[model samples]
Target: MPVFGIFVPPTIKRLRTSLYRDALPFSKNLRLKRRSDVDPMGREVSSEDSQRYCNVPNLIISGPPGCGKTTSVWALARDMLGVQIKDACLELNASDERGIDVVRDKIKQFAARKVTLPLGRHKIVILDEADSMTDGAQQALRRIMEVYSSTTRFAFACNQSDKIIEPLQSRCAIVRYGKLTDKEMLSRLLYVCSEEKVEYNNDGLEAILFTAQGDMRQALNNLQCTVAGYGKLSKEAVYKVCDEPHPEKLREMFELCVHGEVFQAFEIMNDLYRLGYSVDDLMSSMFKIVKQIDLPEAIRLEFIMEIGKCHALVLQGLATRVQLAGLVGRLCQTQSRLASD
Candidate 1:
């Protein structure tokens, strides 16, 4: 198996120079490129991605879901092709079909065919969610790569490369990626807001990033949802749409449960539901509240145990409306009971 690492060929260096400088014989006017192709400040390739602009064609991009792995690589391909990317590159989602034959067919087309201009400079295949491919599919891919080394360049995008077969791992240069940093996310968000000309409050961008958990797609989607509801955007609107209710709201619900207000507690739970708070969200917040107070270990243990039971019931499909309501009531009651004691 060939070792996996970036080896920038001399040809790529010359080509890169020619594309950027006007003095170069092949250099053309840069005014024709679309704004979307550049970054927020109009640099050609994103600074973070320029390190990856070297000559290594077969590449593996690993990162968590929604970190913009798919988008970044496609952008690189688009820049390389010097045209709108349509058929010159193919993106395959491994989880959708989960069959090796499907991958084989696509690989055949990507490797064997020659795409005309206005598509790309060279043919590229982006295997999105590549880690989801079955062992059979991966084995088939290994065979395919051996057959077509020059014409087809494969880029595998996955959250974890450890899940990929070693043989397949050895065949490509791996680019490990982490979640978008706060600055990077903000940069991307500001770009979006500026382009759409959406009116935004000072904290609105922070609110989007906080709730997105480092996923660009999540942030983008939340931004869209906020815009849809508020017409223009504001921090409060984002908080509301994201269901990032005030801490007081959670405390109120906790208080209702603690006082043995089973019916009222149930009502609060309904409100949370209407507000789109998921079960995970409710449990996570409840856990945080329990952690804040210095409660006795034994008592806290008991509460944790009960909460775990309720969580399992909810997840196991055994929970009824009454049962879930009762669980919430118990959790709220437990917290208040601890406070009093």
Candidate 2:
């Protein structure tokens, strides 16, 4: 929970149970196998997960950006007695050089540095965006973790745990976080609006929520920018401030695709492209809108898969209007085939 506000999810209640359980005592490290299990949020929870994670000294906390992974560990470090969190915790983020050298020099040195702490409270070295670290660095860090298991604890915060090396991941418990619900985000937004005297209409807030896609930091940042740029938060203002492909226009385009109106959909894509939006911007917006729109289940899934392929191409530097046009054409073909069948 931030000093400004709290939006901890229910899955985190289980973590609280683990955190307060035995005050971070490690009886013995579990020699678990290398597993590719997705985080708790990626799949259903098991009763064993709650019990197994409490005593693990090292943790691989994975989630989307702004989902409170880093904050949770900070809160834990703050609550410890007999040591200042600033002194006991070694923090590294994406901006830092996270190569093999840093793991060998910086993190290793931190673990070896002697510091007194409350019994069972080990010094924490937090690596934010651990997925960005090099494989060699992760390998080196895993060895350090094994060597220094008694004196220090390691916490790796990342957006995707799968990128972590298997040997390293095996030694740490995996914790997954998900995006905030819309209702939770809205309540917080409304509170902020009242506190800041920010005038916002429902449509404006809804746009923020849509653009935010469950990331609180993005929502708040967009909200602030909208207020700064427009003096008030309205649908048009938020959209203009954020400046992405508008969902309403994308929805109109998608409806055309559903009816096999290829030229119409391409016209919308061309217009959005001419507005200076990237192909990635349009493809992602299309994907998000497709999830909630009322369409036949088979067609919806096919559309999403095609959009994903186009998005991949966009990421690979083929971010042209041609890719967008091709994606729209594919969606139209699917709908035409479905109608014929």
Candidate 3:
């Protein structure tokens, strides 16, 4: 006969002892305290618990692109969840995975899961570009919000809050983020340069600011591009990255238009276009230059009105070249009329 081996099953008491032993280290690790939570700038930002709206279950943050809405959400999540943030937060881009399916499947599944941490804070679901979701998806989301309000909180970020359903909007605290001020932007740019050890001139910084138009993300990106391409930040490098006409050249084109030199102005515009400047960029630069034009009040007003019309056309999907050429022709007529007067 084959040798027989006797096996003894573990007792409940022994099993329980082993399970507790294995879990002891995990429990200790979970309770380990973090030293400090600081932002990128080394500032001690307030935690979510310290915020007045921490009690709010839902939030809607509306702002222009690159205005720090998403960054603020990240900071808030970090503050609330600490080391558990990555597992406690779900980030979804509505523009990318839009529709009721995502809201029902991914969002619902995540929200229904039991909280893993004992921090007493609800899990966070961040929906970026929230306004991009369809009406039906948004409607479905409203129901999910109701069902899971206790276990999860939502932070919706969008360029426009009006696109969200009224019921959904009413259920959340709406916060509007404004564009960064010139001073704030400049300070941030300077800080970046110091951190990167990149050489930059004031003119170059100003160029980036002007092109960015209060968008911090855009400003930083332009700065990086300028530095990477030129190995130094200068006004010319910034302009090159922006693919914008030089201020002096733009001024020349404006003067040509204002003086009824339509041919010359069109030639300049064509050359700039060939050089890769976008029509939108040209329009923006012209608008700024026109405002500073030293012309009579009536002429200035007329120019503003005409340019405004052209801009509206451009926004309406009119061919850029056609609208720009028409704008130049109108400016020529206006200048001729003013000269006669």
| Off by more than 4 A, model 1 | 1-54, 84-87, 114-122, 244-279, 285-341
- Which lDDT tens digits does candidate 1 get at residues 55-130? 4357787888766567667667766665536767778888896697786787776777766643224567888899
- The candidate that wins on lDDT is 3
What Cα-based lDDT does every candidate model obtain?
0.69, 0.77, 0.78
Model 3 bad stretches (over 4 Å)? 1-54, 116-120, 255-281, 291-300, 312-326, 332-341
Tens-digit lDDT track for model 3 on 1-341?
Answer: 23576554568659977777544422121221322321332222233544633564588889888766776676777767878887889999999998899998999999988878654588999999999999999999999889988778899999999999999999987888777777867877787788667898889998888888878778877887788789998998998888777777877877887778999988888888788777777778888768765777887888889888888888878847878789888987887787789
Instruction: Give Cα distance to truth, residue 77, candidate 3, Å.
Output: 1.4
Q: What is the Cα-based lDDT of residue 38 in candidate 2? A: 16
lDDT tens digits by residue: candidate 2, 1-341: 56777888889988887667524211111111122111211222222532243343577888888665775655445544224677788889843677888888888999999888755667888889989998888889888988999888888889999999999889887888888678767876787788667898999999999999988778888887788788999999888888988889988988998888999989988999999987777877888899988888999989888988888888999987778778888988997787788
Residue pairs with colliding backbones in model 1 are 81-121, 257-332, 257-333, 258-332, 258-333
Model 3 pairs whose backbones collide: none
lDDT of 1: 0.69
Error of 3 at 331 (Å): 3.6
